[model samples]
Structure formats: C-alpha cells, structure tokens
Target chain A: MTTTERRLRTAFEDAARTIEPGSLAPLTIPSRRRRGTWTVPVAVAAALAMVLVGATLIGDRMRGGPPPAQALAAGGPQHILAVRAGRAVVEDVTGHRLFEVPRAEGRYRAVAGTAREFFLAVQTTEDTYSFYRVTLGADGAPSRPRKLPGPLFRTQTGFGKPENLAASPDGSKLAVVGTVDGHAQVDVIDVRTGAHRIWRTPEGGAITSATWSQDNRTLGFLWGPKAADLRLLDTRGDGAELEDARVLRGSSIRSRAPGFGLINVFVFNPDGRTLTAQVQGTKTGDHDDTGYVLLPLSASTGEPAGRPVRLPSDSFFVKTDTTGRHLLQIIDGRPGRVEDGRFSWISRAADYDDAAW
Target chain B: MTLFREHQLSLTRTALMIVGDRATAEDVVQDAFAETHRRIGRLTDHDRMLPYVRAAVVNRCRTVLRRRALALRVGRVHEPPVWSAESAAMLGEDRREVFLALRRLPRRQREALVLRYYLDVDDAEIAEVMGISRSTVRSTIARALAALGRQLGENA
Candidate 1:
C-alpha cells in the first residue's frame, strides 16, 4: 500500500478501534489550525495516546520532585536565541495562547553548531563574550536573564551569521555560533577559563548549523554552497573524513536571491547518518519561505548507504535541535525509515531554534 | 470533551513516560483532560486535540520543572521516562529512543520538541500554546535539532 493509503487506513482503524465519539470531545469547527498545524494532524493518534500519558507523567515528576542534587549549583544552564518580537504565535482553538510570554522584547533564533555550551553573543560594540540565562515559566513570565561567569576571547568562525549562545547541560562550557564577516562560525569558550577558540568554515559562506557528539569529542556542521560540505571538528579524536569534508547528498537549491542558496544541515541522527532540514527559498528564518527535506550522509565516497528519507511533504519543518547525542529523539519506526525507529522532530515548531525550548 | 478518557489509559502512559511516575501521569492526564475541556473550544481543531491535550499536560509539567530550577538557582533537568529500559522497549522504536533522548535535553528543549514533533503542530501553534512568539519557536527548534543532531553524529 502507498504510504498515504497505509496512513489513512491506520488513521481510520485507530479511529474505529479506539476513538469513541465521547472520547473525542466535539470536533472543533475546522479553522486556521490546519494552516497552523503542518499537513493533517499526525496520523498515529492511537500510538501517541500511550506516549501522551507517559510524557505528561514523566514531565510531571521532573517538575515536582526535589531539585536534582546532581546538577552543580555554581553554574547554571546558558542559552542564546535569535529572539524576534511577535512575528508569529502559538495558540489553541479559542485563541487562548499556550506560549504566554510578554509580547517579547525580541525573538531569539538558535545557532546550532558543535556542542559549544554557550553562544559568544557580543554586541558589535564589544569583542568580548558573556553568558545569558533566562528562565521561562509555563505561565510564560521570564525571569530576568543574568550573565554567567567568564567571557569569550575570540572571533567566531560563523562570523556572527547565525549568532547563537548555548551552555552545556553541566553548565561548564559554552559555544556561540553566528556569522562573522558574513560567514557562519562557532566559537567555544571555557566557562571556567577565559580560554576560547574560533571555528570558521574553511570553505566560506555562513555555517548552516553545527553539533557535538555525545562524548563531545567530535563536532560537525554544514557550510558553503553547492559544494557545501559537512565539516567535522574533533576535540580529542580523529573524526574527520579523510578528505576533511563529507558533502551532503542532495541538490543545491539557490535561495530566492541570485547566487544565494539556503540549505542547512538540520540534525545528524544519533547514528550520525541522517539529516533533516529544508532547502529554503531564502535565508531568513521564516516557515513561509521553507519546507522540510531529508539529507542522508554517507562515507566521503558517494555510495548509497541508505535511502534518503523525505518528511511528509505537506508537513512544515521547524528549526529546533534535540539534546546531546545520548539524548532522546522522538522517532517513528515504520520499518524502513529514520533509523532506531525514532524521528527527532518534536512539539509544534520549537521557538528560537534550540538555544532555549 | 472527554477525549482524555478516550485515551486516558494511554494518556496516563504518556504522562508516566514524561514524568516517570505512573501515579503522577494519571493525575496529570486527568487534570489535562479537565483543562482540555475548559479550553476545548479555544483549542480550535478537533484533529489536534489529542496532541494539544498532551502538549498541555507536558507544558504544565514543564511549568513545575521551571520552579524546581529556581528553587535550586542552578542545576539540571531531564530524567528518563518512567518505563524500565526493557519495558520501554515495548513502545514503538521512534517514541522510545527519541523521547528518552528528548528527556535528556534541557526542560525547555524537551518542551519545544514535544510540541513540535509529537503533535506535528506548527511553530505558530507552538508559539500560541507555549505563549511565546513564533520567532522564538523557530529559534528553540533550530537549536534543539542542532543539539540532537550533533549528539547523534559525533557520538554515534
């Protein structure tokens, strides 16, 4: 059966076998939500039902239990964002907003790069970098963000293009990814030490994104144009391809602007084989301008290691990053799909990239 | 209005997965359904109510978590779903691994992910539900994905 047909059957079967007229509450008069939701709502309601309960419960325990003593009290989580004031909003049917923050001062966009803990966001006026942390409550009131200890001491390779700040879970290290000199680069700063390093895309252009391995031993990201390649930086191991770069297997679609292409490396699956992103019509971060695409990574040689998967074309792709490689990724295991039976996309569209959630 | 009941058993499970406590997940789902009923009309689409409700429960839980952070002033978040590793295996492959990894993310990242992928909801919807602007949704998702990708690529 076609994927669509199977999904339809699954939806119908799920609906028939499990959906009680009463269980559903009256269906909302269809309105702006489809536009608001990507494609039709996810087809696997029955399966997700179990996940729904488990997720909420787990989330609750994490919330109520005494604070985890494991976390060091000295340094906290550091985050950066490409914050923009009210461009779009997340709300439910009656217009009661779920995300209840101030009509923000600005929106924060995440700059994804190797597992640099914090983004070295320095105002143009200063070359030094500091850490910023803002705590957001479910009620949406944000605690006044405070700067953490130490400061960055180098110019980033992203050149501040996708300027972003992030802190390691332990809050000991911070990485800042952004465009510098029109190129995307990531800078790593020792939260304990003033020491830092500037990682520039050797090929040129903005760095689309970057990530660090579980051990934080290797860092990888996308950079350059048609010849754009995946760059891996190893802090302690030899992780780079023999050629020093692994080119993504996909067409290079130019951005709406002539001579510009807006393809980014979305996420390197835990196995580090699959990538998800949108080849957009423009460079700016607007869903109006983009759709999701899957890019498969193979050995530096162009061998078909596995089939490249495409997200349901109707589905809109968001710009969020999952946590450490050892971190969990939401997956859909329908046989031959994203490996480990997991798909990493989560919640509606995540805000401000992943600097914060 | 009783959609939570339709899937209450499962919702109970989902909550447990997130909170790591069966009893608490049941309470959360029950409350979530009640909240969903209160917010029913406002939720807009019938199709998305399940995820909406799920997101709501998860959001509520995350709310509790933020307070925990403040109580400590600085520390950690992210505990595995309640399922034992073996029992967790009973879940669909995608849900188990990803959710496990997701919990590893900062609370905000985990919340952003649940709303983004689990519900297959859009950024605007997430922004509305999370009460943040769409731009922030975009930023969080981007960073979250990058974080996941990096962890997967280099470590795997």
Candidate 2:
C-alpha cells in the first residue's frame, strides 16, 4: 500500500482500537434449559388425534368464511432461537419452550403462535413424552410452564416432528405443523379453552415453515421436499381456506441465511391483506437478485389472487412493521457471527438499494 | 492481542468520536472486545486483532446510526425521545469542531473516513464490511478525505 493509504488505514485503526462500548446492555444472564419439566400424562395418540380434528374444525370456524389468504411479500421473523451454553434453547415468542429438548426433539405438538403469545407444546424423548402450557407476558418473556390438559393422542412415541408454529389471528387457536409419526399433518390447539384438532396432510410433504395473518382468517405454510410452496388454512374453522395460495417453487437461498434459518422470508404486510416471500434464485451468491411474490387475501380457490411482486432487498429481510410502511432487512457483508445484529429498512418501493448502504 | 491495559482508553476515545455518544461508544468498545474474545483463536496472527476490532466498531456505529435514523422516522416510539448523553454537556472547541464536521457529512462518507482514518481499515476489508464494491469503497474514502481536508482546512 502507498504511504497515504497506510496513514489513513493506521488512523482508523487507532481510533477503532479505542472505541467505547454499546449503551444498551447485552442479554448476559445465562439461562438454563429447564422448560419441558411440565407434562400432564396425556395418551400420546389422543393428543395427536385431538390436535388433528381441532385444527381443521377450529381453523374453519375462525376462517369467517373462505377468505383468500395473503402471502408474506417481505417475511417476518423466521425462527425464534435462544442459545444457552452455546446450545439452542427450544423456545418461541411465548414463554413456553421445550427446554433441553434435543436439537430436533418433539413430536407433532401445538405451541403458541409467535414470541407474542403463549400456549401448549409436546415433546417426546425416546419413549417418554412431556407436555407443557407456555404462557407469555405482555413483555414477551415466557412464563413458567404448566402441564397441558386433555387426552393425548394414542400413538407410538415421537410420531411427528414440529415443523411450524402458527396461531389464529384471534389468538384462539395455534396450528402446529408436523408429521404424524411419518405422516405429514397439521395439529391445531385452542388457547382459551385447550382444545385440539388436526388435519392429516396425506401429501406427507415436509412443512418448511408457516406464518399466521393479522385477520386470523388464514394460516399460510410452506411445504415441500426441496422446493417450498405456500399453503393456507382457514383458522376461522369454516373450511380449508386453501384457495389462492401460491407456491413460488425452486427459488434458491442466495443470501447469508443468518438466524433466519434456511427460511423463505414469509412476511405478512402490515395491512394484513397481502403476504410477501423471497423466491430463491438458481445461482446462489446473494439473495439480493432473487425474485419475490405477493399474494392478497381473497377467498377464491386455485392460485393466489395476485402475481408475486418482486422485492429489491439484498438479503436480510427481518420483518414488516404493522403500518406496512417500512421494511426491515438484515444488512449484508459484515465480519461478526452469521447472526450478528445487522439490518436495515427500506420503503416497500424505492426502498432497498442506496438506503441499504 | 492488543492487551486491554495498553489500548482500552484509545479504543474508548475513538468509539466516542465516531458515535458521538459516550455510553454507546463504551458499549461498542465492549462489544468489540467480546467479538475479539470469540475470534481470538481464528485470528491466527495476534497483530490482526486491531483491524478486527476496528472493523467491529465501524459496523457497530453503522448499526447505532441506522437505529437512530429508524427511530426518528418511526415517530420516536421505539427509542425514548432524547438527545444522546454524549452531546448533553457542551464540548470544548476541538471536540465540537470534529463532532460538527462528522454530523455534516453523509453517513457513508463519515463511515468511510472513520474506517479509513479512525479505525485504520485497509480499503479491501472496508469494502467487504460496508457491502460496497471495492471501487465504490475507494471512492467513498477519496471523497471523505477531500471533505475532511476542506473542513479541517477551513478551521486552520
């Protein structure tokens, strides 16, 4: 490097070496993974069955009559993971967590919707099954676990794996997407009264993830082997509100997938009418160039109401604010851990490019 | 590793200068140390820790600055509406001159200068951290240097 370059570089180095610390205190208390300690013995088979029927019927009731469910044009928080002692603490937005649940523990059990609500969860360790009712406070911190009530599904232990945690908009029902033993299905649980309903998805397809809408009229899920497609369920309990759900298939995850998991960015616009998602591109470098699609909430079957609108963000889409005005996305190319707190905001239109810098 | 006893004050001062907020700067500095702690083994070469710490601070500054801008646009709801503590008391002329010059510059220019002159990041690494093409990173440094030269020149 030239003399001037060396001087400039050295100057920044000296200044950088002398930085103070962040004003906001970090989350430093080490928490133990003691979540799954609560389990009221429910016959495993019974719990599964109740979840199946309850999800179908309750979701139908909440659907408020077959409204076309929208898609998350720019997705919300993908995965809620907590690390205790360098291991992921199995927890959700609600206070409930399958603490100490192995990395991939738990059967097809229903839990609360997001970090916002609290509900029930079931985890199976080998032959033993543990159930807990997780309560979340207004502050979003999880409360102590209470054993789940009602008859558990009578089935072989560990039949299904927890896929997605989606709740009805009314906060009444939560859909736990998982496999029944080896069968792909969605288990529904009622929050206010502790009821269970489930729908056996014969497709046995893997549910990549799911998101609930603001209307509570629909639940959207992505299910597939490698390519993920969007599916909607009527949480209103009226019927399978599966009309107009579109699957943008074969999209490659081209960005740094940090804490977001290998998730397809599924975001429900704040207006609660539209859903947006990032379609992975073929060539994987940065998802910045990948396409996106937006689907509106209208109750017409066979394909989503609108075309998938393309977003111009260069990866790191966090969540959409309630107003739908600003889009939060992670800023790319940093030197910290993959999950380093780096993100930016852009207007739905004219938003992603220079604003990212 | 640059031992804390030797470099702590300098790191704190530089962070304060860039962020223009004491508490935030301290936090940034602490975070830089924590990040260093995590990567100490990966750094391989002990001398490289300084650059890594500098990069971390620049990135943190960008984060805090972006957060400030967002809070402002979001109607001051997320963060409490108040001037940062660093600017609360009146600073002497030299500090104020530096602060005002920084505040007047565009975000990228200030960051480029901070990384290039303050943090002492080489152009290539700065380019990587900032997510800009190297050429743009270089241009950003050039423009920032020219502006700083003029700003400091006027006072001289």
Best by DockQ: 2
Off by over 4 Å in 1: A1-129, A134-144, A152-172, A182-184, A201-203, A224-226, A237-263, A271-292, A295-356, B1-156
Q: Given candidate 2, what's the lDDT at residue A200?
A: 58
B-chain TM-scores per prediction: 0.62, 0.67
What is the TM-score of each predicted model, taking all chains together?
Answer: 0.35, 0.34
Q: Best lDDT goes to which candidate?
A: 2
Give candidates' CA RMSD values in order. 20.6, 24.7
Interface RMSD for each of the candidates? 14.1, 23.2
A200-261, model 1: which lDDT tens digit per residue?
54333334445444444444555433234555555443332223334544324432221233
Model 1 reproduces what portion of true contacts? 0.02
Candidate 1 C-alpha lDDT tens digits along B4-36: 556665555444444555445555666666667
